[model samples]
Target: MTAKKEVVMGASTENPAEIQDGGAMELVRVPAWEVKYKLDRNPDELAHFVCCRDLDWRRAVCGYEEPEAVILENPTTFCTMCVEVVQAHGGVPGSGRCPFDDQPCPDDETVDRMIDERTSRP
Candidate 1:
């Protein structure tokens, strides 16, 4: 069998009128704290965070609300109740529940405790 050559697409040419003679491109700056916080979180967690942001943006931009569902397959995923809330609010993949709230617990420490508990158990 003969090997087939793949065709490549070229980059589109830029418009001359779009370029400014003296004006320089301005870079929009996001807060350093936000960047640092985002980086410190796990990639999967970050994806969920971004999803929440996108949901908010969608609501603001077009008044369109996405249906949210809580995935409870994994401990890391959101709880079923939270998913229902997200769906009611028109969000997709609602925020997860704290893993360590058997009776009553603080939100911040629950995740770390849950991780420890899960790791210790198995």
Candidate 2:
């Protein structure tokens, strides 16, 4: 009998606290903040600000040399930098207590829906 490789789901190696949205993990597009930057002259740079860069510790995990360089958005994982900033500021990082009071970090369904909406747009 051949043994199957058991794949562990939920939370990425890069971030243990990250939330997993199961299958939605397959379709994560750019960060939700991209909705704002889609029309900006400096979209890349401005998008980074949405994840927050004021905290010094964020620079290490963020891995972006310039705000304009970050583009990948993992649906299963909240931005580590964003998480740290939220926790540091006494707010939570997930759907319950997202840093942006107006825009809470959405759940898996919301993330996937946003991606679909963006793609379906004319």
Candidate 3:
């Protein structure tokens, strides 16, 4: 059996969750305060605090709408819903529900494919 090669990547704040070299994209842990500072008044830029689940679906990720969400996802006072979903998803949920979204769950075909490819090995 060959071990899967791990590649560490740093995505720009403009495009945070891009999957690189066919690898699962791990979100860079940017502090909520720093994000606000960098974003300034750029509405298009992402202001994620608690993995808004708004990332690229191909990367198998996203949710919240900012400011308030950022505050809620603070290390000291994260929202219960956010924490629960995060826990359920193993840090990054394949089909996790976002606290901001009304829908219960989101589609994640990438995760299904990854499971099949990794587990079907003999």
Candidate 4:
């Protein structure tokens, strides 16, 4: 079995603002501050690292299995450079290729299709 891993955010924290719902139903709106880091790390790399760390470290603390991979809303914009770094480390970018293999990266259309499929799913 692949070794389980967890990622933990080092110096980043999220704060949310609560807003009242205007509709008849009682609702609370919690607007979160986007994830932010203290160090000058590449955003994508940071995200990847955090994901890995969470799977490798924090999952155990929280009592869960490590996630195989993370999904980003905008894969292209979120971690282009980090993908390159992960690729250099032998991992595939975009298609979840093994970092230790030479598999071809998934094309943009594949990613788009995945996004569309996910969004369309109920």
Candidate 5:
């Protein structure tokens, strides 16, 4: 099989999970810090900053909103749903466990790989 040609694409902080590929759409790894920082501030502000500043989305791919979550046996990814859960639970301090899992959240590398593989399809 021929290797898929990887293309560089930009994504907004408001919705990083969705990526534009070949006029179609695919999900990809959007660094954790981008999501976390966006979660910390107003979504509109974050989106504006991302557009104006062209923030680096690959630098901190392992950031977490909750200080404790990062130290858990398995760290969880900071995604759109994760942000919603955190907000519903009253932010990081109020969120004690992973919303999706009973144990803990998945790690950064694990989440990144998952996204990469899913989006690398031909």
Candidate 6:
């Protein structure tokens, strides 16, 4: 049997304070004010994609060369860049965040409903 390493989920390797587990860490999508860009991004490209760029050490994780290129493409992961873009443009008019933003564990009723719906689907 192998030893189970305790993992500190959602810890940024860039920050010394976030490191809790002595083993591997999980990459976080949220960008706190102190986070520096660890991913490989070019300065030249960074100059153009202002829509996805945050006015901080965070780099363009989306890697779009032009401004608002992500909108032209399909959105997948929830990132700080996406949040910045949405908020910068007056944000969502009403309540309720994007369904993709986070995956909270379904409550008992919600889970039961989902299971019933899926089972009933043709």
The root-mean-square deviation over C-alpha atoms between each candidate and the true structure, in angstroms, is: 18.9, 17.8, 16.3, 14.3, 14.9, 18.9
Q: Estimate each model's TM-score.
A: 0.20, 0.32, 0.23, 0.29, 0.26, 0.17
Cand. 5 TM to true fold: 0.26
Candidate 2 structure lDDT: 0.33
Best by lDDT: 2
Q: Which candidate number maximizes TM-score?
A: 2
lDDT of 5 by residue, 3-46 (tens): 01111224444543333342222245444333322112222221
lDDT of 4 by residue, 7-27 (tens): 232322232222222331112
Local distance difference test values of all predictions, in order:
0.26, 0.33, 0.31, 0.32, 0.28, 0.29
Superposition error at 107 for model 4 (Å): 0.3
Superposition error at 111 for model 2 (Å):
2.4
Worst 10 residues of 1 by lDDT: 1-10
Score residue 119 of candidate 1 by CA lDDT. 28
* Candidate 2 structure quality by residue, lDDT tens digits, 1-122: 00011111122335333325333332353343333212223323222213321211113223333333223343233345544655566665443434534344546575445435433435
Candidate 1 residues 51-113, lDDT tens each? 211211111111222233221112253234434444555544422522222122225355344
- Whichever of 1 and 3 has more TM-score, that candidate is 3
Model 6 alpha-carbon drift over 4 Å, by segment: 1-77, 93-122
Question: Which should have the higher lDDT, number 2 or number 6?
Answer: 2
Report clash pairs, candidate 3: 52-62, 52-63, 52-64, 53-62, 53-63, 54-62
* Candidate 4 global CA lDDT score: 0.32
Q: Which 10-residue window in model 5 sums to the lowest lDDT?
A: 45-54
How much lDDT does candidate 3 score? 0.31
Question: Tens digit of lDDT per residue, candidate 6, span 7-65?
Answer: 01233477665654443244244222333222222322222122211222122323333
